[model samples]
Target: MRTQALGGRPRQPRGGVPFMLLLAVLVSPAALAQGASRGARLFAQRCGTCHSVGEGDRVGPDLHGVLERRDEAWLTRFLESPGALIDAGDPVATALLKQFNGIRMPDQPLSEEERAGLYTFFRECTAKGKGSCKPSPTQKPGTDATPEEVALGRRLFEGTEALAQGGPSCLGCHDVRGTGVAGGGTLGPNLTFTFARHGDRGLTPLLAKLDTPLMRELYAKAPLTEEEQYALKAYLADASRDGSRPRKDRDFFFLGVVGLLAALGFIGLVWGPRGTDPRAH
Candidate 1:
């Protein structure tokens, strides 16, 4: 048969057309899935720290249904150079900067292929519904905080729960919105927007090393556990979403009273009793 086919275009392979068709049908879906997967990874690495696809705004606007809100062409231009658009005073860009509390969505420098992938990922997220889109493995799950995490974080930050390693409590020098009247001290900066301002990329490293002049001394011997850091980060992230606000004044008088009481109790412990001295004859 092969000898005969050599004279007549090799008579084609039997069932060749059907086999090729089958291969295309089997491979196409996998190729599409792979492309979308790649897109998701790119989105997480480049855009996810500051923007959420469905879960509400982070440091920037939520990108769910973004293509629906803004045309792909416009989005392309904006994503490529957000600062340029803002500088040119594009009305929408200006409004976005204002709406998100003056935090600019940083420009994402992407080639055409990467931009296409991100666009694809955003579309997939919109189709999946709010909070349904699972990020690629490369992404951190910090885009949204669970209620449990926020509550635990709150307790940890307020010193109501003791830290594992006896590190300095955040409440000793910082304040948050719901920390209450006597809750937080004011020696450090208010952390209302610290997470929002720094996001995971900037904040995670800072927390891990505890390298600041004061933090090094304070937490050097008693570093925060990973769990503790995550919990506190969750709490601060929740507060950051609340945006900037005035810190409530701490009840310093109560603190002074407590300190005085503690001092007297220590003296009593060292001496014989509350009314007695160690040197009594």
Candidate 2:
């Protein structure tokens, strides 16, 4: 998008060196370490069977962009016990079962921290995707958030300002914009990591659910419009993917350190060989 001139107007001069919006490609070393720590191991042990980052699907669907497709609560529920949702007439789960030849997904029990780490794995892939998304030179980065998009999203999230309808903003149930309560209201589960969990597929369904029986039963049918959905989605998408990239020169230092320590500990155990206590000798 061309930079807006003064008075909030977009002015593109002929041959005015039309600039491409380049974000601060600053991914901190800490974020990479955090991503690879527990999440990397958890993904390998739990999700590695059916999924690979760039590889296609196996028994089940490919999970590469799952975080972008579904939201956190949906993923948590599905993972905790797939049968509950599949049997209880959940459309998405039903579709999944059919897609996978009606084979049931075994229930998985992941600690909150473990699930959070998996979220990190999903986020890393999405971050790489964002970096690689190439919009046509003529087209604005509409789907992806620019700084201006983020500002718009933030405003839409907080209800201090009003939207088109009498309907309130998203700040009602979920926490966003890093304000109010850290996790927001209790009627709904915390949405802090939702973007990392469901991603696009998950967020897309919520727009339809704005008028669903569940919403009507719960919130007296407080419907969200298409614009509201777009704005809120933008807000969530922008906020959720925030992390720093590790320095390219130095990679896997933490893992190397951990591996070295583990090797030393193993050597110590073997230092006392079978039937021979070195201290005794």
Candidate 3:
């Protein structure tokens, strides 16, 4: 004769809770690795152009031990809205702006999960030390360009250094601030802030394909070399930094004035003048 429970089921094993806890401990590293992997991809897509982990600062400060330096709450808030923090005059944000030459870090659009993943990646990089946080192949280089390399890039863009394939220089169609007396051409969009606008993710592809209507025809036979591409990227990055500072864009100013006058004229034609009442009695 044996005693039996009402439902005739045996009780769960006594060690089950401990076993599950052990399993969780074993699985955590893999989970972290997965998160870090996702973080690496997101970083390359979003932050790799301007920031580095252990390799020292680029456009932004090196983030080797960012977690150690800043608390999680602050990092989360700052990442969510760097511009707002700067505008609010947070000391750290203001100092970072000054440190990075007034190039404001744009606010990132990241879900909570994505932000967690980035944190995991930052932790992984910090644990691994310098040179361990390698950028993926898609990340363009020359972010750590030397001054000489930047100068060479400027020369190339301005046609001071002739292209080996005889392709037209970048200056013919584009403009940048601080180019000498002649300045740059106006055929293409002003390139003063091109790097900031596009980042490496946008820029690398554009350069590699040269697929814009005009660029396609011009560089179809004269493709840029890898070295040339890197050089030009360095120059554009430098110019982008300058564009962050206050400066005048003559073309933009003129166009703005024209637009303002046109708007004023249209308003006048539609409603008479500023103080005129159009109410029907």
* Predicted structure with the largest TM-score when compared to the true one: 3
Across residues 1-281, which tens digit of lDDT does each residue of candidate 2 receive? 11111112123244222221110111122234434445665665566666566566577777777877898899988887899999899899999999889888778788888888888767876788632322112111223656665566667667755655566666655554364545343333234344554444445444434432223443345555555566666666665555422122122222223333343344464345545745454
After TM-score superposition, the amount by which residue 261's alpha carbon in candidate 1 deviates from its true location, in angstroms, is: 28
Give the candidates in order of lDDT, highest first.
3, 1, 2
Clashing residue pairs in all predictions, respectively, total: 0, 14, 0
In terms of lDDT, the best-performing candidate is 3
How high is each candidate's TM-score? 0.40, 0.35, 0.42
Model 3 residue 175 CA deviation in Å: 0.9
List the global CA lDDT of all models.
Answer: 0.64, 0.53, 0.69
The residue-by-residue lDDT of candidate 3 on 125-233, one tens digit each, is 8888878887745344446678987898899899989977889998876767887558776655566666665565456555655654446678989988766777788
The order of the candidates by TM-score, greatest first, is 3, 1, 2
Model 1 accuracy (lDDT, Cα)? 0.64
- Candidate 3, which ten residues in sequence have the lowest lDDT sum? 1-10
The C-alpha stretches of model 1 lying farther than 4 A from their native spots are 1-141, 243-281
